[model samples]
Target: MSEAPHRDVLITGIGLVSSLGEGLDQHWAALKADGGPRPVVDRERFAPYPVHPLVQLDFDRQIPKRGDQRQMEAWQRIGTYAAGMALDNAGIKDRTDILSRTDMIVAAGGGERDIAVDSALLTDILAASDPGRLINERLSSDLRPTLFLAQLPNLLAGNISIVHKVTGSSRTFMGEESAGIDAVRTAHARVASGQSEICLVGGSYNAERLDMLLLFELGNYLWREDWLPVWQRLSRGGGLVTGSMGAFLVLESPAHAAQRGATPVARLDGVRAGRCRRGPGEATAIARRQFDELVSGLTGGERLAVFSGATGAQPATSEEQVFLTSLRHADNHIPIRAVGSIIGHGLEAQFPALVALAALAVSHGMLFAPLDDSGCEADGSAPIDRVLVTQWGHWRGEGMALVAPAG
Candidate 1:
């Protein structure tokens, strides 16, 4: 049997929603201006856990008003909004043509509980001892659909399909912290093999939830006030780049898009996934090797900027720092942009969205400033090329950059 011909996938449209703002215009402008996470006026929103900066998004504009809004969860809403915006930007009004040729792949971290809670409220009206608050505060047009099933992990992708009436193949995969890379890898293989012409791939997290914050703290993965000791030991504080939410891109073959008269925005180069070197003091060393292999397939050092998976934890951040240090040593001196700081650690869903944001920056010549923290500084030994302005007591470690040779 002969193997299918490989094709070059191109990104033609981009849509993004984050605390920084909604739509690519807002996000791209903010990125160039170096915007940080939005202010959380409702600090009690995630009470009982140490406070962390979160990426805030405007939900009102993203959710549809009529039928579409009636059928999805917040996470689904995020994905749908982004996908629609991206399609629109790509000059695709009716997705039928693209839908017939593409598949949907999603990377999700959380929000199933929100669906359950909403369902419980709808079905058990009598169980609502506090109907006053529920009626006044929690009502949504989206919650009215009894037939809608948004609790499933795949609901984000499913909702997109339903809205677009995309009867093609759709699948959602779960990959703990690696889901972002995993989703891209899945899409890359399918597109490369001619199984799909386009892939709407991204992830989203309801990180503002109190429950998630508590869970992260329980795992000792959160950065709270007590991390002051850890911060003190650091030679360089990182930048904050919060703006969590979902991002979607219209990814299709360059040939197919050209055949359809669509302009390309960026190339969906390639993605690699595997455990980086990290254990005890060797965290940085492992990360360096891992990232090196990640870009190894690209020939001739194509000026590459990395969107690192920095979780703001001791091991994760330190390993990332080592990776950046290695890049500097190789004379790459690539800039590092951290998104998790602003968006909080989104776990599974964070990477896909961050990838979209970084890709936008790479193709557009913008570098979002990290949230500023006077006390926080980059690791002196690491040789970071740029600093994202970060807020005080906040740490930023995830990085996204463009591919460019030493300037």
Candidate 2:
């Protein structure tokens, strides 16, 4: 017997929600406007710490039942809704046959904690003479057992399956930025190797919460005081502004897409994900290697563009900029857009978001204007035939993906 013929993977649909707004049209309009209202940041609610909040969404459109919406946490709701959008965009939302065969891969983090119960328990413990006893009582009586299950990372995948009829094999990855990168890599490899024909891959992050804000501030990673575009934040303190975002894409083998008459936004050439030990300039070293591999047969010049997912976290962000500058100086002086500057960092959702944006840019045959002004990202207009999306985690991972016009 011969090995199955290799397949070409294409990004056929996208569902993205962020501070820039919901859907590709809104985000495209904002980016295409060039320097319109910059990314919407909420500096008041979280005080000095800035966050990119989610746009107001009528949940009924995708998540029809109030009961379903009520049980899921914000992140799960966001992800499930985005998956619905992707299915709809691919013209398969109601196609039971395709929906049954679609494999789902999600990148997610542990579920949100119950803030009210936590606060009450802490407050009561402070007033009680027997603090330990009081805590034990509260643990058994106040906390619901299901709360633990609610926080499981896999719940996002479960919710997506229940809300939408994606009944195929399901898998969820959990390591922040690295998780998102690996999820896309798996989806692309599966489609390319003929292991799977259609796959939905992506994740979500909710940044407008007190618990997450406190969590990041513990590491001094939250941008304080005011909002600066990601590239400009280093001058102030160099911290990341988390965003509420949900991004999902429908990937299908070229043959599968053609059979269904589905239009592809772009072709997924390859995805490379790896981690650096953060040893002296290792992020850039890894990125340089991955960049070289990703841009293999592509003509270098203005026709190629780079979309960066650099979180404003120090050292890493600065290091990535250095790599981009190096690429530019090396005659790959293509247009660069640090998307985090516009929609804020989405953690596990960030890389998928970049892939979605890159596909849209290639599909339109144009590059969006620069979101940076520190002379780091240059501005230009070009009919982009290829795009390289990159991300360096605040602490460890570095990844890249190459996308091109679908032939």
Candidate 3:
């Protein structure tokens, strides 16, 4: 019998961090156990608002270094932590060594979370001003700098590039929640086109405060009151009320990894994405194409373990369910894991985490169950594993990834 030909673009490393914990192990454990971390709302930042269930992370404690800390923001810190983990996992001690021959694609979501110029700071400034105070006394550069570097979303990728000395095509993408998947697609294309040998792709977002939530409240994008727990009724899901963190993946050409004797972590068969018309069933149309392109990308008669982008949102998750139910031949018996329930929707930073999780499942032969929020259907008659993950209604996109059997 002839040997099966090698697939292209193998994922070599993954780094993920959320409120449940940091690193792949924490994410893996959280998923296996199905944990749902709540939001962090402090009286100081979010005056009068109580803390609810969220996936908040503290980068200060996780990354302790003044030199590395000079201009880094929370999300960037998270991204750096995950990047270090990924590089270490891949057994590449020096990023400069890899950059000499490879490319870097840092997927990012959300602007830098700098409390200095945030609403909280502005409020403090206004409160401090007294009518009797002199005009000059009311304003100072110390109070607010004209230009703050943390406001830019690309700061994470820039920091990673600076630390790694990555020269080949170092750039960042902002696709709101789809940035992570977009990063993988970009890296995959780069490797396929022989532009570079290895590509670092991932994204991060950390919402440690409730300013975003306030915005969500105003925009009416958050889940309605009925979706919130009794205690969280006052809080809205519109903004960054979840966690603060980062996740990343390393992609290398299959031939390159094999030739260098690098252990293949997982195979990335193919990736495809598209948009549909806006309307009632538009999500289904969009998702159907997304699924078809992804599944059809497979070459041989390969079995599939699907990772659905079920965000727990009523409209989105419903569409995802409809699309998954339509998969042909694959018995609904196949296990489907909704990832966002554990991590919340990393928003734009989401796809990177999803890609990393999918790679982890493929490499380890394990899938984290989807969060089991109220609206989910749990009957076993459907032939789907429908493993109710410990997490709950936190998915956001209508996409999925398949894992091929190990070599």
Candidate 4:
């Protein structure tokens, strides 16, 4: 028996909603504006810690039903909306024949908590004789049944299914940034290996929540005081400022896309994901290995740029900086842009968002301006035919993907 022939995976559609705003044109305009883009941050709301907040969206445009909107939490709504946009962008929103077979791979984190219920429980538990019992009692009585169901990470996938009708085999991943890396990897591999024809893959993060802020602050992973570019944050102990973003991509096999007459945004040449002990030089080594494998397959001399998902979280960010610097020293002086500096870190959604931006750049035939004054980012006026997107998770996981213009 002969093995199935491999196919090329092409990114046909992209739906992105972040601090810069929604859709490809809006984000592209913001990043390519004459004076360079200004970070759309809210420092007073979250206080000390600044965040890139999502722009106002009319839910009715994507999610029409009021009942559907009422049932979903913010993250679910964002994901579902983005998924719909991806389908629409791919010109298959109402094409039941195509959507019926579109697979879905979502990278998500646990849902937002009910802060009021949590506050009351904490207050009461502190005064109760049996704190454990008090907590259980409050959880059972104070929390609504629907709220618990809403908090499940898979609900994002469920909502996407219900709202957008992408009801093919659905899988959801939950490990922070790595989850995102694996989601895109799985989607690309499935399409390229003849396992699936098309896939809807991505995730969303709501960084404006109090619970999320408190959670990361507890880990001492948040920067205090005002905002700074991701690269500059390293000078003063690095920290991550989470953002509210939802990113989704419609990936299709080249044959399938051509058969349907769908245009390609970019070619997803390769994706490599790995993890290692946080020992010195370990993360950089993993990234170097991944970078080598991804680029080894490419025919040389393409003008390249990098879209780095370097969350301003210490040690990891510093290590990634080292790896990027080494790329420059190795005579591969690709211009680098740490995307987290603008949109802020979206955790599970971060990788997909960066990939979307890379696709936009390659499709446009140019790279956006440098995001920071930190000498790490240099201006690149040359045409970019290929882009390398890197994601080094704040705590663990390292991954990279090669995106190039579709022939």
Candidate 5:
């Protein structure tokens, strides 16, 4: 007896909301515009620490009920809204039959902190002789049930289920960038292995919050003062300029999509992830091994484009540069684009957003222009058949994926 053939996982729909704007057409137009895509930086709002703030959106367009919108925090609302857009794009928004079986996997961080209550508590602590008691009293009284419930990371998935009616088996991952990578890897594996016919997978980030900024600042991970492109930031002591964004994708087996006459945006050929200690060159070695495995049998003649999720943070970003250099030397100079330069880093949402961009490039048959004058990016005029997405987390996690045109 012969072994069964492998199933193909197709990306049928993508929903993206970032500083560049919302949806597929908006992003494509912004990247392909004649002026080469201006970075939408909010230098005044965050002041010294520049950020890419999300454009205003009408929540009623996706989340019909005001009551539902009122309960979720900003991150949950963004993820729910993006998830609804994905279902709509997949042409199955109201199809109870299909939605009843669609699996969901979300990658997210803990809920946003209530800045007002936190500020009041901190101020009162300075005057109180018993700071510990004051803190405890405030925690017991000031934290409401709804606010406490909102802090759960899984609430993003719950909100998606409540708003979109995707009541399938749900899972959520909580590590930063690695969480996003694993979410996509798990979704792709399940559908490709026939365990699931379809899956909705992705994550979102709220970068405009002061609490998040304070956390990163404590670790000295945030970029400050001037705004520079991702690649150019290395010279100024590399640090992350986080962004507010949400990204989601609908993945399905080829046979399942065919049964419903749904068109595919691109095919997810492979997904690979790894992690290592910050010891000297371990991250690059891990990435190299994953890259070799992901593109094992591809021919040298194939046109390849690379979408790098380099967050402009210290050693990780620098190490990713080395890995990319090796790829250029090995592949005779493949075009590379540092996506964070355009949209800023989205932490948990970074990987999914890059994958969505790769799928868009594959479907459109062209790569977006270089984002900076760092000499790392080059213009590509030839049609592209495959795109490689790379992610090196600001601290740990290394991952890569291959995206190609759907047959």
Candidate 6:
């Protein structure tokens, strides 16, 4: 860490892909539109469990080589593609001189599961008189040894390095939503502290697979049948609808970006992440502390807003609401956009996605229409100056980030 003076961290570029669409322009257009098409969501695809499916993309645009795209699973391809988009957005994709120095920090979950093997094993287990032996038989006979290796979480970063030529120091973190929060947090800290000049950080998730839905279904954490606004899902046990998305960000020191003639989208003021046991008021308390600390740095109210990574899961989402309501009581009146209402839950990628959306809102000098007319989310009128991004994971982890206009 540098002691002389920490550099200001700027969001020099952002690359986001979600059910909304690919690229920032598509997302902005979809969000700001008044009453045309609603957010992209599919109800009948997985039946009972409605999901926000990703749009069909031409992978060759970002990932030029057919071989590179073939080696990766859906999540890896999505991440590699988005990473290239970030580099291009920063105007450094072709500048190998700068890319060789760009560090990368990725937050990722496990690779996609093999549903066929799982289903066969389950079927054998149900029919066999000796269930344990049947399970072992399927594990030995049906599963390929190489299958697990292909799903390694770090492969996302590895694929990015191979496909995009970003060869600086690389790091990967895995822990669901907190992984995302800390990925951005660490990248900002590195830039601000002079440990690194520029960093590419984010993650991706493929939620369309039955494996992910089944994983959550086992835990009773999946929304059923009809799709509803995140705020309105409480009536049906408050579960989440999965969305496939890849979110990557280019973070650079203010001096570094200016030196390279790169335009910054917004300034990252602060980020704080923590964990709270599922106790009564633990998550809310930690969240409010982070919110107050981050908001203290803003110069004025200036239509400040919060883009929340609420998973529509119980306890965490409700506690986050408590924190927001507390802010309102203090006259902060910072409106919130439950981003999951639009993009669904991307788990490990949720926090970064919200941060991306927050930066976009501030850069555009306006926030989109209220996601729901419910009293919780208020419409945005004035241009945004400072925005807060909040994340409370389904099981644990509470995080916050402040993205403000680049001076």
Q: Candidate 3 lDDT, tens digit per residue, 314-350?
A: 4445555655555533454444444443455566556
Tens digits of per-residue lDDT for model 4, 215-298: 899989998869999999999999998999999999999889999999999999888889888899888888888888878765
lDDT of each: 0.54, 0.86, 0.55, 0.89, 0.89, 0.85
The candidate that achieves the highest TM-score relative to the unseen native structure = 5
Q: Rank the models by TM-score, top first.
A: 5, 4, 2, 6, 3, 1
Question: Mind giving the per-residue lDDT tens digits that candidate 6 earns over 32-65?
Answer: 8876227688888798988998978999999989
- Return whichever of 1 and 4 wins on TM-score: 4
Residue-wise C-alpha lDDT for candidate 1, range 1-407, written one tens digit per residue = 11223766677777776666677777666555524434332234444333433245444454545667766666677677777777776766476876666677777654445546656677766778888666555555435334333346677777777665555677777655566556766776677677887777767665555555555566665543322222232343422222236667667776677778887666655454444334454544434444454455555534444444455565456555555655646754354444554444455556566666655655655455544352232323232222221111112222221222112
C-alpha lDDT of candidate 5 relative to the true structure = 0.89
Error of 6 at 344 (Å): 0.7
**What lDDT does model 4 reach?**
0.89
* Candidate 6 collision pairs: 48-225
Selected candidate, larger TM-score, 2 vs 6: 2
lDDT of 5 at 291: 78
Q: Quick one: how many clashes does candidate 1 have?
A: 32
RMSD of each: 7.8, 2.6, 6.6, 2.5, 2.6, 2.4
Error of 2 at 27 (Å): 1.0
TM-score between model 1 and native: 0.72
Q: Lowest summed lDDT over 10 consecutive residues: which window, candidate 5?
A: 1-10
Candidate 3 regions exceeding 4 Å error are: 1-7, 34-64, 113-151, 223-241, 297-303, 328-330, 368-370, 373-400
